[model samples]
Target: MESIKASLPDVIQQRIEDLVNAQTTDEEMAAHIKELGCRIAALEALAPEEKGEEAGQLGEAVHRLCERIRRDYVAIAYRQGLVDGMRMDKLAAEE
Candidate 1:
């Protein structure tokens, strides 16, 4: 949705593009993205009368999805030795 695009932070937009273009055998990233999309769609499907808490829950779901993507990105980067410093605590923080 255009509104959704407008609402997203630029960093998040870039991250989504990066994830889509990333070269890897793992299908989990794509699957996770798909699941997030589905959750967003479900949120959109909610009745107009049922807006507050349902929307909040959906927001949290999206946050969790973003966190997962970040974790996976960090893990893959660490595995490839792309970055010099790898900390278990950083990865654990995502959970």
Candidate 2:
């Protein structure tokens, strides 16, 4: 969680704010996940399969890092759905 904050505190903060302030539905989260998958695919395509190249290795590392972030976002979005389903949002609010 600290690593995530260090990397994208703004994004995470904005997402949480959005979830709390608006009707962020599960459908929207699913679409974001699908879009991330498409973006990852395109990124992987740009990094050729050849080995021993420093750039490709760096790109692969970055790809994995991005995948991790995307997974975290998915979890966040799913939890938002759960909170809404339970009506927990009513108990929580941002000032």
Candidate 3:
């Protein structure tokens, strides 16, 4: 695992540190993401339609941010699952 990680890019290393190492469960993350989406929608709703393209751009940018976060989380979950599976396999072998 260390060898595999060492070969990856520095950005991925940061992601593992920032996300995969977190103690949060998948459900908690999903809920948090849902909340963020709701907040985004609420903020967009508050923007005056008369303000025109700027408000739309802001909403689109925020939405993209959320989507990026969600995508990272999917990668995090997959890596975590792989680690969990490795642990289980090790335990089974020991038995």
Query: In terms of lDDT, which candidate is strongest?
Result: 3
Instruction: Please write out the lDDT profile of model 3 over residues 41-81, one tens digit for every residue.
Output: 77767888776467667767987887797789778778976
- Candidate order, TM-score descending: 3, 2, 1
Ranking by lDDT: 3, 1, 2
Question: Of models 1 and 3, which has the larger TM-score?
Answer: 3
Candidates 1 and 3 compared by lDDT, better number: 3
Cα lDDT for residue 49, candidate 3: 79
CA shift of 64, model 1, Å: 0.8
Model 2 per-residue lDDT tens digits across residues 1-95? 44343435555576678858754367875786677666656666676567336555565676678668767877987887675544433333211
What is the Cα-based lDDT of residue 29 in candidate 1?
Answer: 60
lDDT of each candidate versus the true structure? 0.62, 0.61, 0.69
Model 2, CA-based lDDT: 0.61
Question: Which residue runs of candidate 2 sit more than 4 Å off their true CA positions?
Answer: 1-52, 88-95
Off by over 4 Å in 3: 1-51, 93-95
How far off is model 3, as Cα RMSD?
9.1
Give per-model TM-scores. Answer: 0.36, 0.38, 0.45
Candidate 3 TM-score, C-alpha based: 0.45
